[model samples]
Target: MIEPVELIGLAAGFLTAFSTVPQSIRIIRVRQAAAVSAGTYFMLLGSYILWLVYGIIQGAISIIFWNVIGIILGAAVLIMKLFIWKD
Candidate 1:
């Protein structure tokens, strides 16, 4: 069973991981990424990768899981920005 504090951490992770989803969806829906900053997404992706590596080293499941999700979401935005969406 997850303790209350752990559950709070997991919830926070989940929210943060999925926070990019709305942006991704909007980009896809509009088929435009004129306002999206590829540089920002690149930085976010790098941070997520570093966090993932640290989580792996620390054997932190929540960190690993959430960072993986964050990576995927961030990648989706980047892909749309770089390849699919156009101004």
Candidate 2:
């Protein structure tokens, strides 16, 4: 049985991970990565990495999985912003 804290973490992770979908879609569809901040994404990626490591250490699969996905998405956005931005 999952504890309440685990369940809460799972829900929060799911929400945060899924919430990026729309922004990602918008960036892709419009091909406008100008509004994306590389610094912010990098910071987010770093934070996620830490969270993932912590999750692994604590045996919290929810945090580990969500942070893994978040890292990927965050990297993708940063890369896209770097390559696609005209300025």
Candidate 3:
């Protein structure tokens, strides 16, 4: 059984991981990528990657799991910005 604190942490991580979804959905729905900032995406991607590596080094499953999702979402957003949604 997960401890209460761990569960709370997991829930928070899940929320943070999923926080990228709305913008992704909006970008898909509106098909607008030009408004998205490449700099922001790059920063997010770098941050997620760093977190992923840190998780791996520390054997942190929660960090790994959430960061992987973050990477996917970040990649999608970057892809959309670079290829699919280019103005």
Best by TM-score: 1
Candidate 1 residue-wise lDDT, 20-81, digit = tens: 99999899788789999999999999989999999999999889999999999999999999
Sorted by TM-score, highest first, which candidate order results?
Answer: 1, 3, 2
Write candidate 2's Cα lDDT for 1-87 as tens digits: 989998887789987666656667888899787767778878888988999999999998878889999888777777778876544
RMSD of each: 1.2, 1.8, 1.3
Could you tell me every candidate's TM-score relative to the true structure?
0.91, 0.81, 0.88
Better of 2 and 3 by lDDT: 3
Report the C-alpha lDDT of model 3 over 3-85, residue by residue, as the tens digit.
99998999988886777788789999997977789788888889899999999999999999999999898888888888888
Q: Residue 29 in model 2: shift from native, Å?
A: 1.9
User: Model 1: runs farther than 4 Å from truth?
Assistant: none
Ranking by lDDT: 1, 3, 2
Each prediction's Cα lDDT score? 0.92, 0.80, 0.88
Give the CA lDDT, 0 to 100, for residue 15 in model 2: 77
Better of 2 and 3 by TM-score: 3
